[model samples]
Target: MTAKEIFDSTIKEIEPLYGNDEARSIAFSLLEHIGIMKTAVLAHQPMETDTSILQKWIERLKKYEPLQYILGETSFYKRTFRVNSSVLIPRPETEELMEWIIRDFGSVEEDFSEKPAVTIMDIGTGSACIAVTLAKEIAESEVFAMDISEEALKIAKENALRNNANISFLKQDILHDFIFQTPLDIVVSNPPYVTENEKSAMQANVLNYEPHLALFVPNEKPQLFYQRIATFAKKYLKPTGVCYLELNANLAHQTAELFDKEGFTEIIIKKDLSGNNRMLRAAL
Candidate 1:
């Protein structure tokens, strides 16, 4: 078959399962991967040829594999980063988190007298998206990251190298580690905030395909990671340092309360494009 035929066939087969737009996205991505641009694929004549690439992706999609993982890369903040089952696919909302950090820290770079190096630590830094993005944008900030999952850390480290981002990756269980090598200028995290009770509400693609360690927290203690990370930030963050979080909408108020109780003054909760409570930033 020609590339156009293959793309159409793939889209038809997967549309029933993933809907029209996502199916089209999957088809176009596969065609692109095989060196067939949309224009070229459309114009090419039909031919008797193998269609294994489309079939393989369809099979994976049937099992609920995320397209980003199937494609092996995803766009975030105008840059591409490798993604897989080992790490959560970077999302546009997370890009907003990076933008927020840059807006807050980029101004600090303007000081020329005894310019202090800002240190940033990303807790549960899956795929190192935030850390690498910050390091790339801020230029002089010292970025460090930690994750308990070895598989996730591996992918994160690879992404850091691929992006040429100077971030120090350490395999640490944040629940256990409370001290930092040095005081941090900011502590940011996009931790697992999806509570067990909310899993049934997640889309099938996310529920079945995304890594649970990076997506969920126990229902019994939904805000456990946030509490731990905030308390740690209190201990480790510089007096003027800030803590930023990409939070669960359901618990935005509670998450802010947690920070307030922890004595993080000047807490601010911000919503995503969807207008659900999505992120929190606070200063010590």
Candidate 2:
């Protein structure tokens, strides 16, 4: 079949699962991934292409599998990072968190040579998207990323190398006490904030395909990671160091309160593009 036929058929098959706009978007992405241009498909041009791979991707899409996991990589903070079921796909809100850090610490015109070294750690560095982006965008940043899952760390390491972002990867659970060789200028995370109860509200693509260990906390203690992060920041963060976190919209205030109780004086919650309370900045 031609590119147009493949694209239209893929969209038709998945439209019920993803809705009109997203289905079209996914279909276009699948075609582009296989070397068919959107322009050709749109113009009804009959571009010859492989059908077997396309059919397989379409089958997965019908099952509501995330396209990023299917493609094995995604664009985050304008850079491509490899992703798999081992790690959660990087979200736009995380990019906003990165932007906030870059705005505060990065200069568009300066490179590492002119800036003093800063130490930053990502507590749950699933895919290392946050760590790699900071290491690339912020000059002279010594970045460390920690994840409990060795499989996730393997993918994260590959991403760091792929982007040429020098980062140290550690396989450690943040819930347990860990040692940092030096004080940190920033502690950042987009950790597991979703409670088990929230699973029903999430799309099947995310609920079924994304890594649950990276996405969820027990319903009884929804604030588990944030609590640990607060304690970790108190112990390891420098007096002037800051913490940036991507928060669950429903638990934003409670998460900030955890930092507040930890004596983070300058606690501020920031919203994402949709204006949900999605990010928090805290400092001593």
Candidate 3:
């Protein structure tokens, strides 16, 4: 079959599942992954077509499986991080959090302090995207990432090595262990913020494919993770240290309130590109 024929048929096949924008994104990604550029596929009659793979791809999309899982990697902070069902696929909003950290800390090379190393810990660090990225960017950063899921910690460790980011991977539950003898310069997290009641508000691709443990909290306690992390930050973080978190847009105020009760000062809410209050920053 011709490449254009394959392209058109693929779009026609998946457009009903996702709208034109997402369908075309999936189509173009598949084309690029298979080494057939859009113009080449359009110009040439045949561009080394693979029927079986194409059929399987279409079937998966029909089930609303995230393309990141299908592709086994996603772009984050101008770098690629491998992803799977074991970890939540890193999202663009998470990138904004990373950017905020990078901006706030500034580069170590730019700092003239003789003691330049900054200690950072990412709680519930799924995929280690934040830990790894900070390690790579901050230059003089000593980073640690923690996750309860052994599978997720495995992937996070792999990503740290994949990016050559040199972050320490610890398999620990943040909810259990609150000990930090050495105070942290920064603590960041994007822990489970979605409440059980909000499940209906999420897309099928997210609700079905993403790991529930990484995405949700009980209905009665919508801010459980934030509460725990914020309270921990009060004890573990340095007097001048800061914490950054990704917040559920619906509960930004509540998350900030949690920080305030923990005696965290300068509690502020920041919005993503969509203008939704999606991040919170606090200091002790």
Candidate 4:
């Protein structure tokens, strides 16, 4: 079949399950993967072919598999990240959060010293996106990351190595008793903040394909992770240390209130590009 024909056929099949735009993206992605072109002019040229592999991919997509998982890689912070069901796919807003961090700390090298030696901890570091990005961007920052899932940690470690970033990985459940051996200058997280009650409103690709443990909390205690992390920051973060979190937009006020009650000053609630209250920054 011609590239256009193949893409159109695929899009028709998936548009009902996903949406037209996403289905088109998937169609073009598959065509590009196999070197198919919209024009027969390109088809006349010798192109790579592995029909069996392509068919397998199509089958997976038909079942609503995320493209990142089917391909086993994603891009975050302009860098390629290895991702699977073991890790949460890095989102664009998280990249913006990293941008904020980079902007705030970029001048510290000249202001303080060549190697300022700041320490950061990432709680629930699924794919280690935040930890690795900070370690790569910061001049002299020591980064530590933790996750409760051993499977998730394995993927995160591979991602850190893939990015050529240095990060200390810990296999500890943040919900359980775990303490930082060293003081931290910054604490950051994009923890699971979605509530059980919110699941019905989520997309099927997300609700079905993504890990529930990394995406949700019981509706009865939606702020559980935020409270725990804030309490930990109070004890472990330095006096001037900063805490940042990617929050549930619907619960931004509640999340901000947690920090206020926890005695964190300068609490700032920032919206993502979509104008959703998506990130929070506070100083202890």
- What are the models' TM-scores? 0.94, 0.95, 0.95, 0.91
For candidate 2, give the lDDT of residue 244.
Answer: 94
> On a 0 to 100 scale, what is the lDDT of residue 247 in model 4?
92
Q: Write the per-residue lDDT of candidate 4 for residues 46-128, one digit (tens) a residue.
A: 44355566678878888878898998888888788888887899999999899888887773254546555889999999988
Q: Where does model 3 exceed 4 Å of error?
A: 108-115
The positional error of residue 74 in candidate 1, measured at the CA in angstroms, is 1.3
Candidate 1 on 67-162: residue-level lDDT in tens? 888888998887789988878888888888888888887843565346678899999988898988888887468999999999999989898999
Instruction: Tell me each candidate's RMSD, in Å, in order.
Output: 2.1, 1.5, 1.6, 2.5
Candidate 4: C-alpha lDDT? 0.85
Model 4 clash pairs are: none
Every candidate's lDDT: 0.86, 0.90, 0.87, 0.85
Writing each residue's lDDT as its tens digit, candidate 2 over 1-284 gives: 67688788888888998899999998888889989989988778876677789889889887888899999999999999999999999988898999999998874457658556889999999899999988988878899999999999999999988899899888899899978787999999999989999999999989999999989999999999999999998999998999999999999999988889999988999999999999999998
The best-first sequence of candidates by TM-score reads 2, 3, 1, 4
Better of 2 and 3 by lDDT: 2
Local accuracy of candidate 3 as per-residue lDDT tens digits, 155-219: 89889888888887778787775566768999999999898989988999899998999999999
Q: Considering every candidate listed, which one attains the maximal lDDT? A: 2
- lDDT of candidate model 3 versus the reference: 0.87
Q: Looking at model 1, report the run of 10 residues with the lowest lDDT sum.
A: 107-116
